[model samples]
Target: MPRKSNTDVLALFDTLVYTCQYRLVLEPASHVSARVLEWRQGLRERIGLFHESYHMPSIILCSTELPPEYERSLVDAIARGSEGFASFNMNIGGVQHSEDKRTIYLEVGEKGIIAALRQRVVDHVRTNRRIKKLGVEVVDHARLVIASGLKADQFNAAWAMLAVQSVMVQQKVSDVVLIKRELGDTSMDEHVRTFALTQGV
Candidate 1:
């Protein structure tokens, strides 16, 4: 018997179609928590993993591809929606493994600040005619993780048994980062076009 293909399995499931262009997320600053830094460093050492330009602990707001003509409109809408927002607090929860067990992450405990911010962004995007049909789902607890993709499950299992405890900490989210699409870049590229939260401060 042959092994099943990932594509074959994926084909059995419904997936969204849009060129991956932009993502809205929160990248915590270094001062957020000593433990988070320690965990990041430890993961780097133990799994030989490190944060890439795109890899940051984040709370995702919106991720979708829009028509090229609508790009500026989308950007403007995000800017307007996020204009009056200010920094807010969030708490880290413990470890969580995805249903596929293909990823492991630190769960974010529910808090009013993050929820409100997510709602604002969602509302703005949903009302926009350009990408309103895309349908967005705000993850209740932000996922802060050590690793993901092919080897995430292996690392997660090993780390869990290693006696290194995960921490629950609080951090202030001060920025809403926008990662934009770039020419000649694959959908995976992390070319950031703007970090919009500065204007709000």
Candidate 2:
């Protein structure tokens, strides 16, 4: 069953959990209905998997945000080392959307060293960021999701228009940023924190 966003839950030790359909809490006096109750006998049952939520920050993800200081350094380094490379701009072309159980992302184009640069930024964030490490994974596409409850086929028109234009620019990643949201909305959020690419990718 999907994790509950609200309603019945169980809490053994400050952990809010749900067993069956009932909700639970920690305090000894808290009452629970047998309609849904924690399975005291199944200690061997699998616990669960949890992941840190990530949202694309408004910095490089948005056009108006200030360029990170490290971006200049990364750009200069790439220009010097990568052949056939000149200058590039930070461009976001891929589109992605996720609702309910599904998500969609847009594809980013332009291969070569730009991919490497993107990796560096990802590595830096995964290593240095203070709060929680957003797992590092190379997203090959700048994906856009049309949304759930609607047919994926509905995106045919959008895909056609986007399909014609290459979105990932050969330029700099600009910066890495940390974005925050309330509880959900895992899609993309306005950037609340930022790291510049002017100094490094």
Candidate 3:
């Protein structure tokens, strides 16, 4: 094979499609995160082989795809939407499977707050022409996925073990974080900004 020249490499790079995806998520407090990690480790020990280290434990608010130029506007919209939002406690516990029984996750009981916040953020971002055209998807269920990509038997085994156990944790959500990832990138999410929630007056 002939060695590729700089010009050829540059051309190939230019031809590649790069899609910028943005997501807004609620990151649990530090202590809450530690407990979740411990629970996950214990689950792995009991269940045998599984791989899901890349997944972050968070309540996804909204997800969308837009051009790089619109990112600044997106951040501004998120900030404005989340301004003066009150902090609340979310109950994260119980093991359940998706309708297809292909995913296992911890249930987030309080849906009111999540829905309200999602609406606020999406409302703000919808003002942008490009964003409106692309459309943003609001995450309906606020659950922390512990394990995914399971076969029928794997799902059954994991659920059978986890469902019987008592697992409950309280996460005090104080802020929401904005994260972004480039198309085809396998690395962890890059943090763009954090919007702090305000205490009730």
lDDT: which candidate is best?
Answer: 3
- Residue-level error in angstroms, candidate 3, position 163: 3.5
Candidate 3 at residue 78, lDDT?
A: 91
lDDT of 2: 0.31
Model 2 residue runs over 4 Å out of place are 1-87, 90-107, 124-137, 143-150, 156-173, 185-188, 199-201
TM-score of each: 0.62, 0.34, 0.76
Instruction: Specify the highest-TM-score model's number.
Output: 3
lDDT of each: 0.60, 0.31, 0.76
Candidate 1 root-mean-square deviation in Å: 8.5
- Model 3 per-residue lDDT at 141: 83
> Which pairs clash in model 3?
none
lDDT of 3: 0.76
lDDT of 2 by residue, 1-201 (tens): 888544334223224321111000001111211101221111112222111123221112211111244333333332332322233453444444444323333333444434555444444333433211212334433322222232344344333433343333233544443433334434334334333444443
- Per-residue CA lDDT of model 1 for 1-201, tens digit only, reads 898799777555324423445668776545443455566566655665433213445556667765456667677777777877876666775766677655566677655676787778778877786477644556665666545552665556445743356566776666787765543312234645544443333
Tens-place lDDT digits, model 3, residues 1-201 = 999999899667545636577889987656656656665676667665454444456667888876677789999999899998898888887777799987787788779988898888889989887678667988888877777777788787778766775567786778899987765424456788999988655
lDDT of 2 at 138: 47
